[model samples]
Target: MNLYFPASSDKKTVFSAIEKYISDQQFIIVNKDENRPWGGFYVIDEAQAGFFIETWFKNVYDPLPRLQEMVSPKILVVAPGKRLSWQYHHRRSERWKVIGGYAGVVQSFTDDETEIKNYHEGDVIRLQKGERHRLVGLDAWGIIAEIWEHTDSNNPSNEDDIIRLQDDFGR
Candidate 1:
């Protein structure tokens, strides 16, 4: 299970919720400065962040046994009215599933074509590499399960891969 908290929630609130809902060994907090204004993520897969046995073996032996896809999964909690930067990645794609509350999504396949839509619980959105996208919190906290799909096996994408075109927080 993943934990979710509103963006406006203070550290105490988040910690309290985590203590009540998540076990100490379940996840590790990896908060970033840029994400402070929005919401935080409870990363379920710690191996995706740093050196791991699976990644090492894959890197050493090109095309290892058919292993499960390398994915970084997390639960995103966007505060009401807060929005993430309009960004895209070159080495990864993403699949987002709205799990709680409502959300507004903006996606663009090309420079000239853009689409905005509202999503609710159980709705899923798929974003391909180089596709510009942003998620906005609606009336309540928006909880989403995000799965980062590493497109380039040789060079997987990480937090630094974000290429922001527009941002509300001047990120």
Candidate 2:
């Protein structure tokens, strides 16, 4: 569960270490821990780098819109009083249409900067790439239609995409 990265480690270096540690589909065994949302980290084995290219592609470009597609859309049903992780994506931007119920949208730039906004049905909010954001269901269950598109990028496959600064589900 623990690996050391040098202070000067770059993104590729850190990613390589993670790749080496978690490659196999069933490489590790974990025991159930009801108290921890993630169960808990148990054991790790060195695994063959069988799917690096595929993993890298998914990590970076899987969400890119297909040719002739206008936008990739998804519907999220958030339970009452629940919230998404505080996270940011490097490769995509999103627009959230509050289709039902109330939504509390929280966003931030720096650690010291934050804004919380409330939206009701038919309201919309835009999130730019790399902007930390979270959506909370208020009072009742909430429904959102999330429309997103890939950001302009030269490589578009650098492998570091959704960076969760904080996660309620411990993921």
Candidate 3:
């Protein structure tokens, strides 16, 4: 979720640079077409790999006063060998599609947590409010996250609420 002033809106050149940058690093390119064209790679640290693909993509679009926000929902790429933590979002819920990799998801229930399940490429997953969920990529695949904002903003999260009963990352 990176945005630039596009002093010239030369999408071709700028996007090319983004692709090169991402490939130069290890970030996998999830989507690169007309609908939601993205041109940058976001690398997640240990904590972030155990969290959302990018924990701070909101500001990239929010801070741009000149932009009209062509879209509300954003798509994020979670490269292979990465994982998100057991957490929930107050502002948004996400729908994930494993477009090019294996997705391992774990959900928490009232008394016990569901065993981590795997999804093949093209499988879809929906995350609702208060549904503590975590994910990780396997092999050389990645996940695309479509974010949808909730109607209410009062639902916030705290560190205490994140009860990571088990984590392969050792969190």
Instruction: Give me the displacement of residue 87 in model 1, in angstroms.
Output: 0.5
Clashes of each: 0, 0, 3
Give Cα distance to truth, residue 12, candidate 3, Å.
Answer: 21
Candidate 2 ranges beyond 4 A from true positions: 1-70, 112-115, 153-160
lDDT of 3 by residue, 81-133 (tens): 55655666555455565544356777764425578788865566767766778
Candidate 1 on 1-171: residue-level lDDT in tens? 344444555655654564344334344545422255776666655554332223222233244322366667566777778888998899998877776666889999765436669998767787899998999887667767676778888898898999988889998
TM-score rank, highest first? Answer: 1, 2, 3
Clashing pairs in 3: 49-83, 50-84, 50-85
Q: Estimate each model's TM-score.
A: 0.71, 0.55, 0.46
Best by TM-score: 1
Off by over 4 Å in 3: 1-72, 79-81, 153-171
Candidate 1 residue spans exceeding 4 A from truth: 1-19, 22-35, 46-69, 112-115
Error of 1 at 55 (Å): 23
- Candidate with maximal lDDT: 1
lDDT of 2 by residue, 48-113 (tens): 112322322233345444533234333454544667778888777877776555678898765433
lDDT of each model, Cα atoms only? 0.67, 0.53, 0.47
